[model samples]
Target: MRMRPLGRTGLEVSELCLGTMTFGTQTPPEDAHAQMERARKAGVNFLDTAEMYPVNPVRAETVGRSEEIIGDWFAKTGRRGEWIVATKHSGEGLKAVRDGAPISSKTIPETVEGSLRRLRTDVIDLYQFHWPNRGSYMFRQNWRYDPSGQDRAETIAHMEDALEALERQVEKGNIRFFGLSNESAWGTCQWLRLAEERGRPRVQTIQNEYSLLCRLYDTDLAELSANEDVHLLPFSPLGAGFLTGKYQGGAVPEGSRMSLNAGMGGRKSPRVFEAVAAYLEIASRFGLDPVQMALAWAARRPFVASAIFGATTLAQLEHALGAAEVTLSDELLEAIDEAHRDHPMPY
Candidate 1:
């Protein structure tokens, strides 16, 4: 696996990050450990998780179980130092954590302590805010997203408070770097600007949804990432299993993500399957495994630091690891671009 610079934090991460949201839910503990071992052998040293994880059906009782599983792996192998672990602090609108309280000065310290205990690590290599407190356009919320009512002055104050809390964590050696997820370009610019003015840690990365069917990051976020040095850590590069062709033709295999969340987290639409079909046809023409093709395509983007991928089984993990070595030709890439043009924002 090729390593890329994680902003200016003086740390490099693998091109592919092992995402662990499936831990303690879809995957058992032993299998989760085995997946990590396989990823380590493949030279994928980065691991990503969230505080409210195991999230097909996120519940209060199961919150943090994913982190606990990763902690167990560290304890079992005594190899905690080998991986660059990244996890998130849950934001507002999620009752599973802190009673749906938004991330603020009062919540950051306690959230950090909880993650540290569950992850069995002294310091988080990359600590991320799961979402913006004001709300986000992610998770198919872009259809009716309106931000005109937000108070700019209040938002700036909240950011300053959060940055102060993060500065304290930096002083105590609890975290090495900071990142964002499901955030807008404007919000990222504010964080960067504020951090510079206040001498706090700069934003290192942003995790957002990017796939064959979802190119939300292609315009503004892409430019911000390239010019500002905040890398894009794209989650769900496979489009919630749509790009993999598993859910094609209305086939929802047993124990599949679609079976649990029937709407596939609001990704269900008439145009989605059409988009998936086009990409699947491209994979067939190129004689490439669809899963590998989807992942390799997303990884080839200029601003991507690492593509975070999740797997519920060892076989799926092994299948996805092949993408670390797959390379697409110029003709194949052009074909994909055409496909995107033909089917933009299918969801």
Candidate 2:
């Protein structure tokens, strides 16, 4: 895997980041450890997780189990320093954590401590707020998104408060850099602006959903990322297994994401299948693996720091790692663009 700069933080990360959302749930502890070891050997140095994870149906009982699994791996292998780990602080509406509390000054310190304890690490490489307290347009929310109810002054105050809290964490050596997830362009700009004005830690990355079926970040957020150097850590780069062609032809394989969550987190739609078919056809025509094509496509985006991908099994992870060597020809890229024009906002 090639290394890329994580925003302007001067920390280099792998082009592909291993996602651990399935580590403690669908994937067993031994499998999770093996995946981490396999990824490390494959040259992946970045791992992303969240406090409220192992989600194929995120339950309160299983919360933080993913981190614990990773911590076990770190303890057993004694290879904590070999990778740059990134995890998130759950924002408002996640009832499993802090009773659905929003991220604020009160939450940062304890949250950081909890993650540190679970990960068996002293400091986090990238600590991300899972989402803004003001809400976000991600996760298929764009269709009905409304910004009219937002309070500008209140939002700015929250950003300042959060930044101050994050700065304290930095000073305490609890976290080295800060990031955001499921945030909008305006929200990201405010975070950056506040950090600059207040002399707090600047936002280094934004982990949002970006894939062949989801191009929501291609416009204003893309522009902001390019101009400000707030690189994107795109999750679901394979469209939540859709782009892998596993969900094609309306087949819901047992133990698949769609089998567990019928709606696939609102990613299921007739158009989504059509979009997947388009990309799969392109891959078939070029004699390429669809999974590698989708992942490589996301990793090759100009503003991407890393394309975060999750694999429920070792076979899946090995197939995904092949993307590191599979470069999209210019012709293949143009074909993908043409298909995107034909089927935009698939989900």
Candidate 3:
């Protein structure tokens, strides 16, 4: 697998990051451990998860099970230093997590402590705010995203205080770097500005949803990511299995994510299958798997540092991990471009 720099930080990560949000929910612990082992053996050095994970139907009961699964692997294998583990702190508005408490300076230390204990580790590689405390446009929240309620002065003060706390964590070797998720370009720009002004850790990456169906990160966030040294760790590059032809033709496969979370986090639509069929047609024409095609397209994007993906089974993950080996031919790329133009945004 190709490795890329994580923003301005010297740490290099695999071009494809193994996402573990399905660790404890759909996947049993033994299967989860096998997936981790397979990913590591397949040359993936980055493993991404969140404290509020195992999230097909996120509940208060299974809040930290994903981290605990990884913790078990670390405890059993004793290879904590073998991989770069990145996890997130939950933001406000997710009822399952701390009643959706807003992240602030007051929330940093305790949140980090909780993650540390759950993961059975002394330090987290890249700790991220799962979502902006103020609010974010991710997970199909864009149509109703509003910024009128935020207090700019209070936000800046909170950022500064959080930076100080993160700096202390860095000094104590609790975290190597910091990042953001479900954040906008403006917020990221301000975080970079403050980091430079105060000599604190700049946001190194932003985990946003990017795929053929969801091109939300292609415009403004694309420019900021390219210029400000913030890498884009795009989640759902396959559009949550929609791009894989699994949910095409209106056949909701049993045990699929859609069956669990009906809306698929605002991804369900009549047009989604139509778009998937178009991509699948292109893949079939070139003898390429639709999964590989979607993944390669996301990986080739200029601003993407790593394309994060998840799978419920070892065979599925193995197929995804091999995407790095399939270099799309120019002819295939043209076919994909044509398909993308035919269907712009399905969700």
Error of 3 at 158 (Å): 2.2
Evaluate model 3: give its TM-score.
0.97
| lDDT-based ranking | 2, 1, 3
- Poorest lDDT segment (10 consecutive residues) of candidate 2: 241-250
Clashes of each: 0, 0, 0
The C-alpha TM-scores of every prediction are 0.99, 0.99, 0.97
Tens digit per residue, CA lDDT, model 2, 1-347:
88899999999999999999998889999999999989999999999999998898789999999999999888888889998999999999989898999999999999999999999999999999998898988889999999999999999998998999999999999999999999999899989888898899999999999999999999999999999999999999999999989887879999999999999999899999888899999999999999999999999899999999999999999999999999789999999999999999998
Tens-place lDDT digits, model 3, residues 213-235 = 88889889999988888999999
Query: In candidate 1, residue 33 scores what lDDT?
Result: 96
Give the residue spans of candidate 3 off by over 4 A.
none
| Overall lDDT per candidate, in order of appearance | 0.93, 0.94, 0.88
- Local error of candidate 1 at residue 329 (angstroms): 0.9
lDDT of 1 by residue, 2-67 (tens): 888888788888999999999999999999999999999999999999999989899999999999
